[model samples]
Every structure is written in structure tokens, then in C-alpha cells.
Target: MSDATTISQQLGAAVHQNGVMNSTGVLERLFSHLFHGLVYPQIWEDPVVDMAALNLAPDEDLFCIASGGCNAMSYLTARPASVTAVDLSPAHVALLRLKAAAAQHLPDQAAFFEFFGQADRQDNVEAYDRYLAPHLDAQTRAYWEGRVLGRRRIAMFARGFYRYGALGRFIGVVHMIARLGGVNFTPLLKAQSLAAQRQFFDSQIAPLFEARAVKFLARRRAALFGLGIPPAQFDKLARDGGGDILPVLRERTRKLICDFPIAENYFAWQAFGRRYGGAGTALPPYLEPAQFDTVAHHAHCISVQNRPMTEVLTRRASGSLDCYVLLDAQDWMTDAQLNALWEQITRTARPGARVIYRTGGAPDILPGRVETSLLNRWRYDQAGSEAGFARDRSAIYGGFHLRRHEG
Candidate 1:
């Protein structure tokens, strides 16, 4: 089958629940199309919080959605036995494979960081050719080598790679709107205290949400498809804002900007600056220099698959996996789908195995949806969930849940 056809089929299985004649179905197709390419240049789910909740050990195995593959790569720092990372987007799968190859082959931290950290240097293309290209599979190689507007896609590394993904473009639009409103986000980076950050947001950034145009666009689910928020997830987010998305967005933005110091929150840097802050700035664990060797050493333990989590768990033996990181993908699932997924999760979970997931709204999604028989097998850590949710530097998700298998 053709690549496009294959992508559609994969996405359709997970995302298309309503008929094409319905608005929900149309939104689903549109999201699927947008997601066919890179959606998250950097996964927003904080791996630090994820690792803390999982309390991973060297012998345990993990299964996680590989959005931008950052968390999967970061998990390697914990020296897990294996990380099975899955995604429906071919682009995401290819990106993870590329990161793995780079981790294994790149000469040093300087070269590696220049390619992925600076991500805008022309030498990155040459480095990819010299160091990374030969190790890649034919599919991944072709993905990076493929031309977009007369330039190879790998050259995106040479042209600000983080700024080209769907989420990146959405942030770019937000920046544009801020500029039009005479609001400057750069000043937030300069704020030395949380009080100062709050002052800047209150006086400069918060009013942008009150704009009629911003409110109009916020109400439409399509506008958030760029953030990888599907129609199903958008409804839950709106419900958080009392039937209006603007308040939810504004509050989320406030948390992102003011709840954490900019120097210590890479998510904030990505949102306001569209790139990672350098030097003293916080970075994804996988990108930290101290963790580089460990990541490189454990890179071989990660396996990237372009598919759904339930399909993968179904193929595993009972009690095989010790950890599962669902991110926010469950927010897109139907009740039956959620139950099917939880069935596989319960069937494959080892004793004391933990499952972690986030929701678009402030509640665990599994109860009353998955069978009580299946749900009862897991012990929900309400306090841990609250703690994880509070510490999540990304500040995009409304709830973070941690559940341990009773087995």
C-alpha cells in the first residue's frame, strides 16, 4: 500500500470514530492529515515527572507513546531493560529512529547538541550525512533525505528544526498575535522571580485572550489541531473552561509562564521563544550533558514501532511490561477503545507495574469506562497524581494520573 494510504488507515483506526458526514468525523480527518507529518517537535509531557512517578529500575520494561520521542530517549537515562515506543505518525517514528541513531553514532556532546540543540547550524546537515545517515534504515533515511520545497528534510536541522512542526507553527501564530497586540514575550524570559513573571503576564500577556479574534479562534477545535489536540480532546478542554476554551487556554498559559521559572522550564522557552534556552537553562533530561553517555549506552535498548499501544501490548506476554506512559492519547479514545486498551494494559502488566497518563480535564478517564473488573486490578495513587500534576513543568495537561497494578 502507498504511504499516504497506510498513514490514513493507521490514523483512521485510532482517530476516526464518527462518519465523514458529521462535523466530528471531518475534524478527525483534518487532525489525521495534519498529524501525518511531524506534530510535536518536542513532546510536552515532562519526563522528569514521568520518571518520578514510574520509579523505574534497571530491570523493568516500559511502553510509551513516542511523541517526538523525547521521553522515550530520556527514559534510557534510568537504564531500563527496554523501552517499547510506539506512534501512529510515520514522521514521529522516523524521528525517534533518527534520535536513536544519533545517540549511538554522534562523535561527542558538542556535535550532538549542535545538531539537535542549536538545531539551526548548517554543519548539522553535513554531520547527519557523515555520522547519522549510514546507520538509518532505508525508510528513515528517505524521510530525512526527502525534499520539501527543493531542500532535503534533514536540512530542517540546519534551518531551525523545532520551528517547523505543527506545534511549532501554532506557537509561531501565537507569537504573531502577541506582536500585533504590542505584547512582548521576551520580557518574561528576563523576569527574575515568579512574582515578576506574574506581573508581566498579568499586565502584558493575559489580555490577549480577551481579544475577539483570539476568542473566536479558541472556540474552534481545528485551531488546536496544531497542538495535537483532536476534537474529542478539545471537548474535554472546553468543559474545563465552563464551555469556553479561552479561560482554559489563558489559565494554561498562565501556569506555563508564571508557575515555573523560565530558566528551569524548557516548555516555557519553547512556548515564548520557539527554541530551547542555552547554558543555565533547563533542558530535556536526554539533552543534558551529564546524561549523554548513559543515553548513548542505552540507546540500543529502545525500539521504535509505528503503531498503536493496544496492538503492541496484545502481542506481549502477560506481566511483561513494568511501566506504561500514555501521555494524553487516552483523551482521544472512546469508552470501548479505552476499555480495550486497559484490558491489554492489565493483561500485560507485571505485579506493582505502574501506568501513567494525562487528561485534558482534571479527572482520571478510566473509571466507569473500562470494566470494573479490569479497573479494580489497578490501585490509583491519588496523592501521587496530584503531586505529578502540580510539578509538571509543561503545564498543558489538566491532570496527571498514576495507577499501580494490584497484581
Candidate 2:
């Protein structure tokens, strides 16, 4: 088998063994591994939505999963007292570390932009080998040393940010499929008017859902599962649009494709255009610079462990964390796991600590749990949380926000 396939197989086996995909859990292990190990730390849920949900104070110390590290670095812009980012995947950890190194050590903002936004420039490997390589921790250094398609190293984003890696290739394939369907989505890059953009969505994109190819693809439980939807979540996603998931998915895809200028949205640039920062301003951070120093400074506060969420929480100090940002991770847990996680959160959370997560449907998954006196100290912000949910475009989650009450 090819090296890429080998890696995927190994990862799949590891995920299955880890109980990440047990049938009784809320999340499918295989799906979570694919999303977290492969799809995430590339194009993930938007930081803007995360920022809105976090409502972080300038001085609050924060802890979050580093998925792609974009949100971690973006959190720095808010001038938080500190931000700790953690992730289980080594690839994600390496990427986050590299970004942190670059953000802190890079010469200037413009050069930083060029390196990350214009990653196709060809000099990026040298830049990493020269300026960034020596500083990388051994693990991250070894990660970049690994080859892509037998190429020596994956550090060649300088030639083009979108030209390398599995994520890039995945986006390319999606774009190719969309193109084959007779939807000329390229104009989305230059759409200056919302009217024009909306026109594109209504005309060329939305109709794809009703197409045989899309519907067929959507019906496959495995295919949807690969997008990180577990069986329960698959049901929720299907029910959210009043029993027709195809239309809802199509509309969301249209938003990613036609709602914003490609330059402004790294997700679209990566998904439909196969290049980031085509119009000059860098796409968001994950696709921006591969090295981020600002994210690293807060790295000490972040800790990545192979253990499950319940285990991670049990080890933390009580009443210490102010916010818990669980990125649909709960969807992968069992009732026992859920109860265990909440027990830790309740013990460790200070009064007024906030917990946020996303689900696969319009309704909150925690109403029964949160309302019961067992974990009832946490109250739900039904209205505000719903508004936040509606605003999220990832369309992969049903959003929720919970606040801990004072005793």
C-alpha cells in the first residue's frame, strides 16, 4: 500500500482501539479520528464564531483544543492574559507549535503574510529550514522532516500553500467534483456584491442537493460519518431541516462557496479554489502562516494528553477554568462518559464559568442533563445560545452555551 494509505490505516486502527468509535458512544471513533486527525487543523469551525462564543476578557486565562491552532493564535489578538491550546494528534500539535514559533520569531507582519498567505512562493522551505527549523522542538522538527509523496519534507508551502498535503488534496477533489456538476463556482472569488454572491448560491449551488449525485452521496452513512457525523448526529442533522438534510447541507455548502469573497474566507479558498489568499489578504491563520509564535507563548498553559476528556478534566484543579470549549466532542461520548465529564466540570468550574459546545441538531442536547439537580448548577442560555447556533456556518454542529451558577 502507498504510504498515505498506510498512515490512514494505522490511524484508523489506533482510533478503533482507543474506544473513540465504540458503538454506544455519542461520537463515532473512526469519524472523530478522520475529522480531528485529518480534516481539522486545516479548515475547521471559524474563529470568528468561536470568538463570539468565547466572549473572552482581556485578562482571562483560556484553555482550548488546538484543532488547527488558528483559534489559539486569534485568541492572542484579543490580548488574553494567557491562552493554552492542546490537541491529541501529534500532527496537529506539530502544526500548532510551528505556528507559534513563526508568530513570535518572524520578522514582520508583511513577511509573515507572504509566508503563510502566499505559501506557493517556493522559498518557504528554505525559510523554514533557515529561520524556523532550528527553533522547532524535536517532535515538530521530525514531523516536517517526514515526506509527502516521497518528497523529503512537507515544508514546501512556499511553493504554494494549497499544493501540499492531504487537506489540500481533499479540497481539490471537492472542487473538481463541484466543477464537473456544471456549477462554475470560480466567480465566487471575485464577487464584490452580496446580491451577486447570493445569486450564485441560488442559481448554481443550491440545485446540487436535488441532483442525483449529491443525494446518492448524502445517503451513505459512511460518507456522512466521514464528515464526522456519528449515527445519532446523522439523525440530528437529518432532522434539523425538518426531515430533509440534503437541502440544509446544500444551503450551508453554498454559504461556504458563495457567501463571502474567497480571500476573506480560508474555508472557501481551500474548498473551492485550492489556494489561500488569492486576492492578497491572507486567509485565516490555519491557512495563513505555518508558524505562529503568539500561539506558542501561551503554549505552556496548554497541555495535550492522549487520555479522554473525562480523564483530562479529573486531573485539573478545582474552580480554575473560566471557559470550556468542547468542539462537538461530546457527540462522541456515552452517557457514562457524559456524566463523568460533567462531574469534573461541576467540581472544577468556578461560579459563572462558561461551557460551550456544538451538536448536530437545532435542539440542545444537555437540557435534561443540565436541568437535573445532578448537574443543574449550570444554567442554559436558551435564547443567546440559539442565536449563536444559527450564526455558525460549519453547519456540522448544533450550538450550545451553558453558564455555571453561583452556589
Candidate 1 residue-wise lDDT, 193-266, digit = tens = 99999999999988888898898988889999888899988989988889887899899999998899888999
| Per-residue C-alpha lDDT of model 2 across residues 1-407, encoded as one tens digit per residue | 76445545543432332353555332445454553343443645666666676676676766677666667767665556756565555666777677677666666555556666676656667767777889887867887788777774544665565554446554555566677888776787677776777787788777777788878877655556535555656767778778777766776676665545545666665566665644335356333333344443543444443334556678788877777777776665556657777888777776677777777666667656543775667767676577666665444455555454454
Off by over 4 Å in 1: none
Tell me, by lDDT, which candidate is best.
Answer: 1
Off by over 4 Å in 2: 1-37, 41-43, 159-167, 230-232, 241-244, 257-264, 277-282, 285-307, 369-371, 393-396, 400-407
Clashes of each: 0, 22
How high is each candidate's TM-score?
0.98, 0.82
Instruction: Please estimate how well model 2 matches the true structure, expressed as its whole-model Cα lDDT.
Output: 0.62
